[model samples]
Target: MSSFSADTPHSSSVMGRIFIYGILLIVAGYFLLPLLVMVFTSVKSMEEIRTGSLISIPTSITFDAWSKAWSSACTGVECSGLSGYFWNSVWLVTPTVSISTFLGALNGYVLTKWNFKGADVFFSMLLIGCFIPFQVILLPMARTLGFLGLAGTTTGLIMVHIIYGLAFTTLFFRNFYVSIPNELVRAAQIDGAGFFMIFWKIMLPLSIPIIVVSVIWQFTQIWNDFLFGVVFSAGESQPITVALNNLVNTSTGVKEYNVDMAAAIIAALPTLFVYVVAGKYFVRGLTAGAVKG
Candidate 1:
């Protein structure tokens, strides 16, 4: 095929392109305005903030808000800051994403490659799980957590997220795996590979794109979750989301808007970093998986 198709006309005139780009730029700026305001507010002193408009540029930049937000901001009477909660979320997200992705991969592999008497029914149940409202499960989940002695603990929170997120992870990988040809599995079996061996040597190696999708998806959900974090965990065990809430909404006589903004940005930094680095792959992976299933 020729690099340029002479028979095909260009989709739009140059002016049309300019109009499209102009609209896109306007929309982008509209969405990014909050972030710009946040950055400006976080850097400006309270005096400047009081005197200046919300969107005005700071004449003097200071990171004191960022420092205080990270370390000594008062959350009610306790002033431990979000640093501890940040690390708690890190530990929580790491294992949850890891375990959920692995198990979801296994579920996908089995449901797609190995036919069982009730596989369709089982997968449908999982699909149903994806649509179940988070609110509906709260009471039941809390009761279950209490029964298991994991209530008000980070470990309990991890289990809750993993269970809730499993359906999504499984659906992603299953859709992706259905696109993979079953012949690959048969050939490996013909070569005397066992189930675990086939999964380890073949399916796993082929699962990179879906794995990235699952990780990014699960990471964002678990890291940003406030309802679960607040409901299931206590003081030291709370995730950054819960702590950020405390920092922003406490009954301090003087509201530290700058500190609140910085704490918000800090809490958001990990998800932002993840999306910035791997975001392009996220959509590509979804499309790759969506091709067959």
Candidate 2:
């Protein structure tokens, strides 16, 4: 009887471990299933894809779709697949991210360390702008851009992202700089450090985490931005989003689902890569800079 009692606890521990491991494996499989399917589908021949079950392994694997998506798939009379748009997106997003991040850091510093009359009012107005839906201002922005002769240019798209990005970036950095002690600023000031000096030299270095967060957020948002790209950019200036939409929506033919899916996946690759690479900093920055203090 005593021997049985000793064995009973050991049995329960083993059972508990088994249950936990089983649940974890099931959850892992559930998450991995869709990714597995996409990879399998990507390599499968079109005939196989059309005929086979989604779970079935590819009878023969090929990189035809990838090659087509990169260079040959047609959008209208244009045979250049997604290569041009890929470079276009890189051009637009780089400037937008850099300029917006710089301005946001500036706004954050001023709002946090250097309070003056009407600062609250100004901050409130900016915060209010954040909640305003993009759709609401679309017409006005379009007209305004058209009037400025800025419509249909990469510059226009960059400016638009900057405007929209400012609100969130400012909010991010302001809250972040707020958590930072003002004594640092005062110390810099006592040493004859002016606004730019303190901002450039002191606060900027410590704010790397917040900057990473801001960059990642703005990069993803601006990179994936379909509506703005569609509206603000036209002709060759249009980003990959526009090309992607064109690719997926041809007027006079049977929709190529395989090409469309492949294009979509290719378009998503850069943003996905950005997140995968910087995801740790994204989380760490937000947690440390925003919430910890």
What is candidate 2's lDDT per residue for 7-44, written digit by digit as tens? 34543566777998899999999998976776777677
TM-score of 2: 0.86
lDDT of 1 by residue, 1-293 (tens): 33456587544667877998999999999999999999999999999999999999899999999999999998767797789989999999999999999999999999999978999899989888877678898988889989999999989999998988888888888888898999999999999999999999999999998898889888888898999998889888989998899888998778989999999999999989988899886666445434433
Report the C-alpha displacement of residue 239, candidate 1, in angstroms: 0.6
What is the lDDT of every predicted structure here? Answer: 0.89, 0.83
Worst 10 residues of 2 by lDDT: 284-293
Model 1 CA lDDT for position 220: 84
Question: After superposing candidate 2, which stretches have Cα over 4 Å from the reference?
Answer: 1-30, 251-255, 284-293
RMSD of each: 3.0, 4.8
TM-scores for every candidate against the unseen true structure: 0.92, 0.86
Off by over 4 Å in 1: 1-18, 284-293
Poorest lDDT segment (10 consecutive residues) of candidate 1: 284-293
The candidate scoring highest on lDDT is 1
Residue pairs whose backbone atoms clash in candidate 2: none
| Model 1 TM-score on a 0 to 1 scale | 0.92
